[model samples]
Each structure stands twice: as structure tokens, then as C-alpha cells.
Target chain A: MSKNIIIASTSTLHGGDYLEYLLPELSVHFEHCKTILFIPFARPGGVSHDEYTVKVSSALAKINIEVKGIHEYENFSKAIKNAEGIFTGGGNTFLLVNQLYENNIMTILAEAIKDGIPYLGTSAGSNICGLTMQTTNDMPIIYPPSFETLGLIPFNLNPHYLDSDTQSKHMGETRETRINEFHSFNNIPVVGLREGSWLVVKGDTITLKGHLTARLFRQNQTPAEIESETDLSFLK
Target chain B: MSKNIIIASTSTLHGGDYLEYLLPELSVHFEHCKTILFIPFARPGGVSHDEYTVKVSSALAKINIEVKGIHEYENFSKAIKNAEGIFTGGGNTFLLVNQLYENNIMTILAEAIKDGIPYLGTSAGSNICGLTMQTTNDMPIIYPPSFETLGLIPFNLNPHYLDSDTQSKHMGETRETRINEFHSFNNIPVVGLREGSWLVVKGDTITLKGHLTARLFRQNQTPAEIESETDLSFLK
Candidate 1:
């Protein structure tokens, strides 16, 4: 079966409500499904799973879609298998990957998504769709058993990608610099997804979405700017 | 033997030459030492170990102290043991920790520093002096065998800590937010050492250095703004 996915850079854009920016796109993307199975393991601000679920639930309700937390189910793998649609909210990528591995649902969810179930991932959630979680900007608060992820896509992602502020005196590595460092150790390509940007993956076609142009970094090559609506299926 | 260490937030400040800001203090930090051993595993910007060593070598030349890379020695542990002073340059924390474990010199180097070998760590280097490298802001680039480090200090260090920019529309987690997420899973205290700030450890006493105030985050406690020269021994 062909895959259907919306991998977004962020759940909430600046000054916007949670999942607000993507609501229009998501409504169409998840039109066929009545509900979305919410994976709240990536708990932003360390919110409890139920609390994070409620936030996503209320947001998706605007489009008349009910949301259920995967944690609410008796068996996580069974939950994913039964899910008609899946939406994983953003938080710490390490925490999300660790929970998925610990619950033995990482592979199950990956298979479910590949089976053509509509899926939406934001920030940390979007990161797991990559070849590895090595390019994540989240803190390694808790170490997962492995850096592996779903591998739904051929490349990795650097979410909420910010350009360097020339005016600022801060010496922290810029998003580009960090991705360059990642290239130093791994050969996987990385997409620097800026806020309000996302990737639309429909089976064999993967296209950049939203207003911003994404930065693409490949090993031994200069990073390129990918405009909206650009097909990125060539990354593999 | 008492510990004599300088753990800094960054190697260089904006518009400053490498090690320019810290040369005065570093001169005193390594006053008794004739030659210092350099650990260039972090390799900022993916520079080679020898290339990184050359940068450090020239920088320390201003202090009239000779420098040597640890990679130059066949017996890595022995080189560390006989070193009068040690300096680990800033770069990718994961790469640094991975290299240390791979070489089996992590414990040896830790012991050497604790035995009164004057040591200096900047950025990724300073991160290893903490209880764990969990608070670092670097990309994971590579998977280290363990997040464990020198544990020379009671708490973890978040080097190059950045304050949230109220004016910017970027949705990335601020340093404080990331550290807060860390607190949810780990109890280790984390010092958010801003660029230009550092910690001076003389035996059991660890004091904040530089002109800027550092932020301290403890589990379940409100983040505090620490003043310069303030002793942080209470974190233990």
C-alpha cells in the first residue's frame, strides 16, 4: 500500500494556536477518517500523556475529528493497528522514540503508516519519520536504546530550523551548523524545516509544503534551498 | 589531591579570536604547566584532530605554554596520566564522549583531572565535567556508548546557554525549556552557563565566573539567576 503523511516542522507557529497553521491542510489530509490516534509520548513542556492528548484532541475537534490517546488503549501495537488515522504531536524526540521502543510499538506504528493510514507528525514526531533521530534539536534528556527511527523517509529532519542571527552575540551553533556537524558523522541527507513548513508524502511522491523554503543538506554537497511544492522524491 | 578546573561555556566569543577572551585567566590556570595535553575529539566543524590541535596550539602559544594532541600518543591513558595540564576544546559533545569511550580513556582522564592536573574545558569540553552530558545543546551526530562523563562536578552543565528571544517568531525550544524537559526525567541539577560565563572549580568549591549571570535549574525548583563569583557548591 502507498503511504500518506504530513510531516510538519511545528505543531504551533508563533502567535498561533496549537496545530492552528496546519488545520486547513490537516482537515483535507485526514478528511476520510473520523478520528486520529494521538501518540502523545513527545510531551512538550513535560506535560502528561493525557494532558498532551487533550490539547491535540481539542485542536483536531475544530475539523470534527475525534482524537484518542494511544496510552488509553490496552495494547499500543493493537492501537496502531486499529487506528484509521494517526497524529503524533511534538516534544522531545528522544522521549518519543524511547517510549515507542519500550512499548515495542515503533515497528508496529511504522508498518501501520506504510499500510496507507493517514498520518501527521509535527516537530519531534516529524523527526522519527527520518532515517535516524541524529539530527533532532531536542535535548537528550533520556537516552533511547537506539538512535533509530521509523525510516518512513530516506532523509533526516532538523525541525524549527532557524537561520543564524548576525546581530546576536550568542555563539551557539546555528541550525545549519548543527546539520553540517551531523553530516560530518553520518551520510544521511537532512531537511531543515522552518516553522510553518511541512513535507507532504503521498506514496512515491514527496513534496515540500507551506510558505517557507526548506534547506536541504546532503553529505559532501552544499546545502540547497527547496521551494514550496518542490518534489523531494529524489533524496533517496 | 585537589581538583583545579576551568569549565567554560564557549571557546570564543562573537567577533573574538579563538581563546582570546579566556587567555588571561587560562594563563593563570596553567601557570605551573610547561606543556598541556589537548583532546581534540570534539572537532568543531568536523575539522580533523590534528587540525583542531593546531588551532589550540597557536592559541596557547600566546600564554607561552606548549600544546600536544592526545591522538599523537600511542598510549592514550599514559599520555593523560603524565600530563601536567589538560584542555578539551569545544565541539560536538556526542562525538567527544564517543571518542573518549572508544579510546577507553574516559576514566583515566577523569582520574587525572581529579588528581590535581589543571584542566580546562570549553563548551562540549565543559559538558563532560558535569555529572552527565545530558544537558548539552549539541546535536547527537553520533551515539556514545554512555551519557556518563567525568562527573567531576555534582551537577550537569548546559554550555552556551541561550535566553529566549522575545522578539523572534521562531518556535524552537529555548534553553530553559529544553532543560525543563530534562528535569522531568532526570534529577541532576543543570547549570545554564551562558556564553562568556564559566565555572571555576578549586577542589570541592565550584564558583561561577565571568561578567554575566548564569541560570541554575534544579528538578522541581524554580530556575534561579546566579550572580558572578557565586559559589555553586550547594548544588550537590
Candidate 2:
């Protein structure tokens, strides 16, 4: 019915070669769409993003797609509200939540997607879709002082996944065990997203990408590994 | 009647004296009781003492009173149930919760204290008493993955107090604000405890000390400074 959602590990400028993994997924929905709205207020982790927006725009232009960083625009309100589609890049989730809460952009962002404007969320952007900010393991280097988040998804997300090494002296609970603890105290399912991987939701079709596997742990039950084609709605 | 509850910052020997402000309140409680059972199990962030029982006993005996590290017992079953008064010390709470959950000691501990054992909990020990481990500001370096704590107190505990210095080059949020972020996700009250200070509970009596004022912050509310004689039952 409508080009819906693209949740990713990160946008092109965020370390990985985003174009190689993202372009194919994006073209599926945005085959005819042009003029993408980009938001970068989420990069408040003290990590400088000299030209995250410019870099992405340059990449999109190579594909004959027109892109613009609309941080400052005429009627900034209307630009985001009526955009053909929007792409949100990854950064510190706390910083993103801080702005979302302060600027009252959460509801409006949700509205844009529900209204049929294709929405793409990367890394920290995807985190805001969870129930609370507690699920994030990011350092509090940035603080919104509030955990309020955009609840586009019912579960928590552990982005940029790394497995715990069982052979080495690098001792610590594996990421799988960490997610287990959340469910020990909480009932929500936590999804681990590996780099270059993504969750694509269009209307009701949800697909996993990058051939990366995810693990799901629930209370009193052992963790189970999930592969591509696994339906996440049942988890909801 | 049970003796008063004295939550200390550490279970290591003499660490309790570091909290001189709590001494007066404990002394008053001692005026009415004869034996005090030191709880070292909560030290590991779990239910079983494992190897810490002998550790607590040796330390307390130096104080010229009868002290038994509950770890002396072969099992946690009889060790906790027989105690007339209990004190839980601070350490890595992850270890504590793991042991507690694995051994199913939380239910036993809660039952013993709720029946009037006059339980005292320090830092890690106190954290477990809360609704969840969400109250602790400890680095997730040793995360047990579960934030579910004892929930004995409705509020979270932010130990090792530090103030915000406007001149600080540290770009991240202050410790207080980071703790405030925790409250944003949950309604649990947060108590900022400075060194040498603690909340002493004897029967219905709750006293504060250590010459340092405490801070209490709630969700969507300005944090307020608390002083001695402050009725903190709102947290318990």
C-alpha cells in the first residue's frame, strides 16, 4: 500500500559502506521517489560529524537521486511533515531522544511514517522506536535526563552487535547473555542488529538483511537464534 | 525485637566505619539488641554468599562483637533464615544478582527481612532491594544483563556522589543528570548518597548522616536536597 520503513545499522556516512548495503533496499521502495529529507541532530555523542549530511548527499547524487540536508529550511515544519520520504542517520541515542523530547518531534516523526512517507531509521534512529531508552548500552556521555522514546517497535534493540568470545581471556558476559538479563527483569524481546544488517518493514512485511543472524531471549527460557525470513511480528 | 538496619558502602573490613554518620543511629539500635548478623551474600550482587561468609565474620570480629559471615554456612537456606539481624555490603551487584537468581535466594532473602530481621543493605546490597537494578549507576562493564533488583526500596541509589562543575571539560552529562535519565524511564525515586553517609533504619526510625546532604530526584520533577530526619519511607 505504501513505502513504509527502513531500519538500518547506520547510514552511509557512519563507518560502514552504507551505499553497498542500503542502495538495493532503498531502491525497492524509492524506485520513483525523489528529494529525500535528512535529519542529523542525533550526533551528540561528542563524536564530531564533520560532513555526515554532505557525504550522504554526494552518494545519493551519484545514483541520480536528489538529496538535501533540511536541518534549516523554509517552514522547517512543512518540509518534514510533507516530505516524500525521510532518512534519519545514526548517532548517540540519548542525544537523539533529548532532541526528540525537547523539540516535540517524536509524534510528528511518527506521523510522517504513518501518513505513507517512506521512513528510514539508522542505528540510534532505530533505538528511539523502542519502548524505553534503558535497552541501549550506549554511554551516558549525552543525557536527555528523560527516557521517553518513540515507540514504533515494542521490543528493545541492541545495535552494532558483537559476540562474546568464549576462548579468550577477554572476560565478560556475551551480548546474548546481556540481552537475557534484560528479559530476566523485563518481558520485552531485545533484537541484536549486526553491522550492515537491517530490519525492513513495509506495511506489514518485515524482512531481515545482511544475512546476519539475531538472537532472541525470553524469561525462564533459553535463547534461540533467528535467521533471515524470521517473522518478528510474533515477537511483538 | 530486631536490631536496626545499617547499610554500608563496603563489606570489606572496617568499611562500615567509613560511614561514621550512620554509627550514631546504629549505636542507638545496638542499645536495644545483642546480636547482629552481617550479610555478605548481597556483596556479590546475588543470593548466595559463596566464599564471602568467612570474609564478613573476620572483619566484624575486629569490632569487638560477635559477627558471623553467612558464607560460613554450607547452604543459604538455613544461613539467612536463622539470622536475627542482617547487613548487606557493597560490591559488584552483577555477581550478587547472578548468585541470587541461580540459587533462587531473592525470595528467601525478601521473606526473611519482611518478617523483621532488621535488614541492612549497603550500595550493591541496597541496590538489590529496589524494584530493579535500574537504580544502579555502575558501569555496565560487568553487567549481569538484568536490571531487576530486590525492589526493597522504591527509589534507586546513586552512590559516590559528585557535583557538576561548569568548568568541567567532560562533555557528557553530570552524574546527577545521568541518574535523572534513569528516573525518566521509571518512576522510582533516586537517592544520591555521598561518602560516609547512609540511611539508618531502626524499627520505624529512619535517620540520615555523614554531614553530607542527600539528593532525591523523581520523574518529571526538580531534584531536592534531603537532610537528617527526612522520612525516606517513600523510597523503602
lDDT winner: 1
Task: Report iRMS values in order.
Answer: 0.8, 9.6
Write the residue-wise lDDT of candidate 1 on A1-236 in tens digits: 78999999999988999998888998999999898899999898899999999888899899999999999999888889988899998999999999999999999989999999999999999999998999999999998999999999999998999888778788888878888888887999999999989999999889999989999999999989999999999996
- Candidate 2 scores an fnat of 0.00
| Local accuracy of candidate 2 as per-residue lDDT tens digits, B1-236 | 53246554332223233334354455454443355666564433222454566555454444444556665667876778887566676655655676677766778887776666767676777667656665454423233435576655555676555567676432234566566655545577777776556766555555665566888777778888998658687554
| lDDT at residue A86 of model 1 (Cα atoms) | 98
DockQ of 2: 0.05
Top candidate when judged by TM-score against the true structure: 1
Badly placed stretches (over 4 Å) of model 1 are: none
Please tell me which predicted candidate would have the highest DockQ against the true structure: 1
**DockQ per model, Cα:** 0.87, 0.05
- As a TM-score, model 2 comes out at 0.54
